[model samples]
Target chain A: MAIAEQLQEFCGERRRDLVRFANLQLRDEALAEDVVQETLLAALQGSDAFSGRASVKTWLYSILKHKIVDTLRSRRREVPLSGMSNADDEDEGFETLFDRRGFWATEHKPHRWADPEDSLEQQQFWQVFELCLDRLPARTARVFMMRELLGLETAEICQELAMAMTNCWVILHRARMGLRLCLEETWFTR
Target chain B: MMNCKEATQLMSQELDRPLTWRERLALRLHNLMCSGCHQYRQQMAFLRRALRSRSGGD
Candidate 1:
């Protein structure tokens, strides 16, 4: 097969996973599919850029990542997180667990999670984690994924989302707390 | 004395930026005395590491 034909076949096989991964980041199914389709096209057309340095999957992901960012930048104007009006309150319930002295209230202490490394290897654990992530409010989920998944810094998240630094931290803290509690209820406790 | 709230905030902050010696000392002392805060700290680290290693999850 020609290089173009081979690359097309490779990317086609991975299209579902690529689109799902994009949905995980972009959180919009339509946009995710759009980027994945664009990624396949870019990968097909930019064969010269492949350079034989990384796996085809890695190269495709890099293109998808940039495409997602570009999509985010274009969509940011409409998203308008500017007023800080949506001050996240999902954390309030968790706050009550910590007392005035900042100690855990009698029943609210975090239980020891089972061997997390073991859990990481379990496919179901990722499903639970992904669901928990989806449960987070949109802005908070975006920040948590950017920081944890994309490995973006706090500064970049603030710039991309047009959020204040302090607000970003607050959202992150709440996001973590929410995920823990969600996992406990859905997977850990069960 | 860093309360659990303050200690947890510092713990989350540590992920974003380097902590000062004083802040580090404060967190260490707090964790030494507070199992809840210690568990909270560990959970945060575990979550971050797990997500990072898994490439933000599959």
Candidate 2:
């Protein structure tokens, strides 16, 4: 098949996963779709630039990630961090799990979760996890994904979001706590 | 004496940054004595692994 035809088919097949990945990062369907489209376009147009150093999926995903970051930077002006209220800011719900001295409250101790390796292979587990992620406030979720999903450094994330380093860490800590509690309540609790 | 709350924060921070000697010692001493904090640390690691795999190690 011609390179153009092959690239077209490749992009066609990978579009959904690419868009879904973008949606996970950006949290906006329209923007996610737009970035995915741009990613596909860049991949196909620059197909000759493909060095074959990485798999097609990985290459496409790298492009998608760049596009997602670009979209995030552009949209940064519209969504200020202060305007993105944290869902957990109203209460120290997780703190109640520990006593005044910092020990786990008897009733609030964490239970051992099912084997993570097993759960990672289970589609239902990811569904529950995704739902929990979706429940986080927009800014928190974006910051979390930028660090965890994109593997961006703290300095990079702070620069991208125009947020302070301390503020970034606080958001990340809250995101982790929120995710932990959400998973415990929804998936781990029998 | 580190509590579960502080230990959890350290656990989460460990994923993103290097822990200071004081924070490490506190968490280590706390985890040594507390089964619940140990479990919390394990769960947090599990969460990071899950997210990394899903992101294709991006």
Candidate 3:
């Protein structure tokens, strides 16, 4: 098979993982789909020197990761993102996003009618969780979902997202910690 | 009343196992002292169970 054809097969096979990783990086599902499409196109064009240092999966992931960074940098966002740094602020950074001192306004207890198994036959849970997921910062939320929701191994996540294992652990730790804190502080306090 | 942090941590672990003797005792002692935390825990427990029953991950 031609290198481009082989690479196309590779990208097609791992499309789900690519989209998942891209979504984690970009936060917007639609935008992440775009990035994955762009990554595959770029990969096809550069197939001449495709090194075997990393698995094809990892190489594609690396490309997608850099693409997200490049996109963000082009937009000139001053705040550094989580996946960009192997060990920057870690999960501790998300805690600050919550308004701790302010009363958690829990007057209207909106129940999530989001049971995938219940709502749709074989429904994708992401569509449901994505509702609240949008509220979290892209990096912190992605780390949390990749670990807790998707059940991806921490080691794989560390390598894919370019996060340290400690940072990965800390990210999960803080995600659980921050979500509970924010929910209680914001929803119940009011 | 249990402080928000303690209850939140307790709830996270509770997803995997039923509260142990030590946890139950600690929680009991905590509830006697903190009404807000106690009520918070009760409500959270109900919410969690409702979610769990739907999740059926177990």
lDDT of 2 at A153: 95
User: Which of the numbered candidates is closest to the native, going by highest TM-score?
Assistant: 2
Where does candidate 1 clash, by residue pair? none
Most DockQ-accurate candidate? 2
| Tens-digit lDDT track of model 3 for A1-190 | 5566657775766587577655754666898788889988888777666886655655666676667656655533545454243432544553343235321234422233223234323334334433444555556676665555344567776776666776666555555555544544444344
Evaluated on the second chain alone, the candidates' TM-scores are 0.88, 0.88, 0.58
For each of the candidates, what fraction of the native contacts does it recover? 0.61, 0.67, 0.02
lDDT for each residue of candidate 2 in A33-69, tens digit (9 for 90 to 100): 8887887788777989988766666677677777777
Ranking, TM-score, top scorer first: 2, 1, 3
* Tens-place lDDT digits, model 3, residues B1-58: 4444555456555543377988877877866765555554555454444333322123
lDDT score, candidate 2, position A151: 76
Query: Which 10 residues in a row give candidate 3 chain A its minimum summed lDDT?
Result: A108-117
- In candidate 3, chain A reaches a TM of 0.45
Q: What are the lDDT scores of the predictions, listed in order?
A: 0.78, 0.80, 0.54
Chain A TM value for model 2: 0.86
